[model samples]
Target: MQSTVNYLWHTDDLLGQGATASVYKARNKKSGELVAVKVFNTASYLRPREVQGREFEVLRKLNHPNIVKLFAVEETGNSRQKVLVMEYCSSGSLLSVLESPEHSFGLPEEEFLVVLRCVAAGMNHLRENGIVHRDIKPGNIMRLVGGEGQSIYKLTDFGAARELDDDEQFVSVYGTEEYLHPDMYERAVLRKPQQKAFGVTVDLWSTGVTLYHAATGSLPFVPFGGPRRNKEIMYRIITEKPAGAIAGTQKRENGPLEWSYTLPITCQLSMGLQSQLVPILANILEVEQAKCWGFDQFFAETSDILQRVVVHVFSLSQVVLHHIYIHVHNTVAIFLEAVYEQTSVAPQHQEYLFEGHCSVLKPNLSAKHIAHTTASSPLILFSIANETPKGLAFRDPALDIPKFVPKVDLQADYNTAKGVLGAGYQALRLARALLAGQELTLRGLHWFLEVLQATCKRTLEVTRVALLFLSSSLGTERLSDMAEVRGTQELRRATELRTQLRALAEVLSRCSHNITEAQMSMGHLSSELAKNRDQVHEDRSIQQIQCCLDKMYVTYKQFRKSRMRPGLGYNEEQIHKLDKVNFSHLAKRLLKVFQEECVQKYQASLVTHGKRMREVHDTRNHLRQVGYSVATCSTKAQEAQENLSKILDQLSHQLLQDRAEGAEASLLPVTPYPIPAPTDLVLHMQELYEEMKLVAFDLQDNNRIIEGLNRVPSAPDV
Candidate 1:
């Protein structure tokens, strides 16, 4: 054992207590590491094995960037007090950051992304592992900033996390009040409780709120006052909007424009940056977080780009990187053997460097010049073993097809270069409708599908071949690993990869189902292009476009109605964003087309029908909850009408007697019943109702007809 530390692990150093546990910064002399340990104040000592086993098992399987690392555990040891040894992130919790001088007023946008990246990575890791990190908040995050630029946040305290198999009902309130999803509160209030819990989306929604606070330097919905019940808290988070203008009032401080709203000290950024950030931020702050693209897509896209972008490939990665230049000359003998002794090189080759008989298999250069290799480049060598005199003329070695490349790497005697860099070989195709410059047709769509299938399949097959070769060599150890001074870590990669593949398959399937719709959109995009004999003019019109554009946008509602499959949830708009296809950014390109086409020929008439479609798409979700609540009012009204009919027969006889006794019929002054403001539940339904409306109204007329204008119109310059 090392020398004893001034503080001992979990010796109860007397820090203040929290709702769940008592915290202490302690030293583990055996490991010589300082760790912040929390010990739950258990009233009884029971099931020691069960407690220790679960914590160890879960911690050992967890691998996430934001989560705090678990080092060692002593559940029934050390004077029978349970203790968890963890990596001590020195900067403390995000709550501390909020209270510190560095925050000044609040966190910046860039810093917020960094925080979300870590936390989301953690949540995603758990989700992939089929685990739920129930308690997520600023207090749980340990922001580690040691030396300059040497910091990474960790999601700590998984004491509340649960495995999928546990089947624990979500009615148990476990998190901070400010960040709970309204659904959980509703589940709590249920007379018949449900264990059919929401998914990892809960943690994401909390993270978004945390970011909102970080951005505005205030709670997204600050409650009227203090420690709130779940009902009131959920009411606000569900009903209240983040206090701001529609986008934001952000602008540069010292530049031409100043911020209209109070800016955070940490964020002295300009409005331009905020505008760029809206797309992603909108997704994060979505009311139903489940609909946001899960972290799996993010990782998959990133991994795909990283692997595909390498300029060179080396078969033998085992070659020592640093010794390369000096060790290069050592392989000369083996190379020469392959070049001359066992090879067919004419003795006259040395005489005529510019040889009369040129073999395609031979290196393009003469034998006088040797092939070059560099530290950053792959080794390439080629030679023909065929002895036919006419071999040089028959085969062009440079044109060797990719499927013929060998996977094996020989030391030097004989070899072939594998994995050619095939660029500028995209099988670019346009839909038949696009090719025709008119309305979309089934024949055109069929051809487009075939092309897309061929391209994607080829890409996948080629990549799988490469990956298989890699797997055979690497044996799936790990692409890379990082070190923490003191902690136990697991790969957790298998889980993430599965989630990604499933998500990709889902996106592909969805696209395939509505491929025609997508084609129609693309067709309209093409009509926006002004065709010359040789090339398309850069300018075009959006409003006055092709018939396909009109069909795609104007008929989106009809198309969706026709194609609606029941499986995409009871309410499709609520569950999936895919209604009619939209390449949102690509539409900007078509917007430029608006300038070239005569507006009179194809000014896409503003389809006010969009307003009615909004109501159609959103009705079930918009009024479902409110309908349930107000059912009582509607029921009572019906009961009163029925009761009035029952009493009318007896009342008619009494009315005749009362007329003789006439009681002042002409009237007390009339008063109006004041209309009560809509309740929180009513308001939330409206907000969701409005959001769905926007998506509904976003449709375009893909069939618009465009005639080339004599002169181009000006577009918004951005």
Candidate 2:
């Protein structure tokens, strides 16, 4: 039957019916706009006048995206019944969605997050206005499809809502029995003879139940029988069970009662997400009123989760889908690392396509940008490549060393060697005048040789052990191929260890080589001094030795000014300053540069290449599928094939144009043949290049140290 309200709205379609009122889909007669007309039944008018008018006042005051909007309040033309004209939602309530067969277990994680965000936002708006919704459940929440086909949930049916501050309390027994707090359930459902005022936290209990139902497709605190059938037992269970324990209880027709303390196996949420959500549920679902979280805390926690959670859909071969969960604050580098951990695909080999376009994956790319790009089309094509694409190469500042061998001053090096020999000759004479005599000098030289030999021997042993372990970890089958190095955490640690050990070995080897001639000269002078230990005039011998030392010092000063091989030699002042250099600080800066310039840049290139390859692979597979379907002679198939063919033709034309514009094209054999996998020679070459750069950096660092050493003054010429 058609009805008219205030001669402005004409109602014909029934939307829903409840205990107090019935809603109908209506249209405004003047402008023909669709709306929902809610008419209160006569029985509802029996309540207090203030209670009867509260819904209208509350609805009128709300203006949030997650709350239903009120248009007007009027009376029926014939019977004078009160009617509320409000914004209409084309889709039904959340209860209807949960009732679908596919959602028998629960709403998927994506849909559940949407429901959670919307409900939390709507309730936050209510609290901001000092309003309390006594009823919060799936049936009271309405769903509507937005312009972009996204499901938007809105809180509706505010008949039981009223202005109540957080500190204030009301003694009304008005809420669904199953979702009521233990205090409310005892008084309202079991008819306990007591007066208990409900605080704002009562709403939190109902919201917890609603979210639990939306996530798990069942109410929490279920008894063997239904809540109404065994009301006393249900009350006992709700009151006696500790907070966050007892997820639910169930019983078959003739089986034993079973209790579960965790989410069921059928739930689609990942463990990472569940870890975050369980705490929120624990806090809000507290049976102890004092321990329960307030709306402020709830809002803060939910808002934080919304800011950090990002769900991406990755597809391998368009058959299987992986729902990857990540955080919004993660960078592209961290995101790729997470992907590698989960999928076992090296960051260098992964390719992806987002929204039918190839993405340029840069290491510093923000997760926010990635989430935005995939918002409309979340399905990303993923693939693996046998080799890196040429276009994927990126410029790294660490690899920009000039291509020239450092020059050496052979003549100046010879002079420095000769001066050192002459210094040794004068040192034997000076030892006779010394108070400690030749014994102390001989002991110092012996100690120096022992320490140097021990250091060199220990370094060699450690290097050999490290090489053995590295070779064993990487089997002999691919000894030189780094492409087979899985991007695992263990492998990365091992690689770092190898680099450090190799550098230490090289340093020890060079020091041992440079000091050999000096050691030999010192040994010869020590033997000669021991053989001729005659008592000489102390003052005269000291003066003669000092003059020889002065001459040798002058020769070294000239040698220090000339260009020489890095780490070749150092003067007395340079050696003294070397002990004061802050080596740890310099090492930290070098590590920072390597990470930012080399590792991150390479990861970015891998992601870009992977995405492009995925695009091409997907397009080709789609074309093949459409062509096969055309054999069925179906009209839809024929149209799809035709469209795909046109796209392929355009791509061919574009390729030709590119070739004409000076892009080189590779030709493939016409006949089908088995193709061999490409060797990892390029990967090895890259590794070599990185090692060379590290060596160059070390040499430059040594040069700087030498410069600092020269700035310090040597002792005045004797």
The numbered model that scores best in TM-score is 2
> Model 1: residues >4 Å from true position, as ranges?
1-17, 43-53, 75-79, 101-104, 146-148, 165-172, 187-196, 226-273, 276-278, 289-293, 297-718
Cα lDDT tens digits, model 1, 211-317, are: 55555444544433422533444353453434231122212222221112233322422232343333344454455544554546544532332232111111111
Candidate 2: 10-residue stretch with minimal lDDT: 626-635
Runs of candidate 2 with Cα error greater than 4 angstroms are: 1-12, 252-259, 311-326, 330-718
Best by lDDT: 2
**Model 1 residue 36 lDDT score:** 66
TM-score of each: 0.36, 0.48
Model 2: per-residue Cα lDDT over 1-718, one tens digit each: 4456432543447788888899998888777788888988898899999999999999988999999899899888678788888888889999888754335456878799999999999999999999999988898899999999999999999998999999999988788899888899989888887877889889898998888788876787777767777777688767766666636554643334454556765455644456567788878888887889999999988887677655454433222233455677788787777666545566665555554344446679876666453323443534333333332112232232111112434444433333333323323222331322222222322333333333334333333332333233222232212213234344344344444444443443443343343345445544543442232122233344444445544444444444343444557436423321322223234434344533444344335434534443443233223222211112222232233333333433444555477652232222234322222333343344344334333433432332222222322211
- Report how far residue 450 has shifted in candidate 1, in Å: 58
